[model samples]
Target: MSVDVSKIVRSHEGKRGKLISLLQDIQSRYNYLPREALEVVAEQTGIPLVDIYGVATFYRSFSLTPRGSHLVSVCLGTACHVRGGREVAEELERQLQIKPGQTTTDNEFTLETVNCLGACALGPIVVLDGRYFSKVSPARVKQIIKSARAGKEEHTADGHVFPVKVSCPRCNHSLMDFSHQIDGHSSVRMTMAFGGKHGWLRLSSLYGSFNLESEYDIPLDTVVNLFCPHCHAELISANVCPLCGAPMVPMLVIGGGMVQICARRGCKEHRLDLNGVNV
Candidate 1:
């Protein structure tokens, strides 16, 4: 599909700090930013091409090259490394027939290594398509690959779901609403606006869960703008949703790293980046 770069640029016209958002939209449409689209963005927005490239390369989330359908990330942090993270990664390479930072021949999977995933207790972690697998053994690599190829979710170790404590990325203030709990954990509270209606939204603190309580019954596919309850800064990020082409609302994971969720109601696209890890 040909990208209408002009239309995307026009949508963000006169918006401050829109370059990141514009690039995100283009990447979301094409799976990666194409050179032609970058030129078009520069021409239409009057932003220099060099500056555009700088922004594209600066963020680890932005990929200049085309990415495969499924992203496979292995964590090799200090804790994971001692726990045989390298062996797990080597097993993945052996199974997928590709090394780190390389996609499979069929463009089905891209393998990458990250420093950490903030789940130290669960070392030897492997994240496939946003799902976490902890304490992965080299022996399980083949099954994981097969499951991913078949589009089936492999159960995490012990079927455990991790809870995350997040805060406002802007003010560094805790966004955890202890008084309002979801999934038996403190909810991440934020104010939002959608379809001209403003309301409070509380999201489940669980990483893999998508349960959220909102003041309004937001219609499906309604893209909302989220703001921090304490700092009032917009929670918008430069990244776009992988599943839906909508802006991602970002929050700081209490320990270290960031968690972003799709702003479009009913879209469960979310990502967890830890210690500069991008997957």
Candidate 2:
């Protein structure tokens, strides 16, 4: 059924400030940029439909079509590339029978590739359902997609799903409060644009070229702190840990730990030989 653009737009009082918020709310309700909703947004804001669409499309965050039940994203960032991100992504596309920008016919899954997710250390990462799976490989891609399709289990890299409460490293406040990934894997769309956090991870994929941004100039991806070095323990971003309650220290720990270096076997966490002693 077509969306009632006028009604929806009118529902929002002509408060210009509330336009963006209203659109976000509406898009959330429909899980897409409904034609009717766009009409409403355009008419209410006195903005041209073309302008509205332009805004929506310009931002990588917005979607124009209905999303699938599950979202699957493969990282093509630099670290992931060095670790075979392209291969993993290709494998996914082959299995899903859909390209990066297309959704499956049944709406079961939508597959896309991102330049990076700020987990460069976790190259070749795959985020399914908003959960990050690092060091992904062709084999792992198969398993991840299978698990998601099954819906009977929560697929995780290294075959382990730790109940970690992810948060922003800078602000100790709850990160989930500001998190906007809608259905995890079903909602994320990846684009390779220069001067973004994923620039390093997107060097090879020159789908389109533009002025190159500086290495450090780009926006750094989310910094995850207070995570367990081992076991992928869910740690809170507080000074005194939430689970252990120990004085939290910022440690560069991702992919579970040294044993589980990343989601890939090649980068499997290993014992560090410090001073000839296995530490």
- Cα lDDT tens digits, model 1, 1-279, are 234778788777766557766776677667678999999988888889999999888656567788788888888889999999999999999999998878888999888888776578888898776678888999998999999899888765333366777887556689999898898878889999988899899999889788999999988989999998886777776567878899888776664445788999889888765332532
Q: Candidate 1 — which residues are off by over 4 angstroms?
A: 1-3, 156-160, 163-189, 194-202, 211-224, 228-279
TM-score top scorer: 1
- Model 2 spans with C-alpha error above 4 angstroms: 1-16, 155-279
lDDT of 2 by residue, 162-236 (tens): 122222222222223123323221111111233333321111111111122222343333222223222323332
TM-score of each: 0.73, 0.53
Write down the worst ten-residue block by lDDT for model 2: 270-279
How many residue pairs clash in model 1? Answer: 0
Scored by lDDT, model 1 comes in at: 0.79
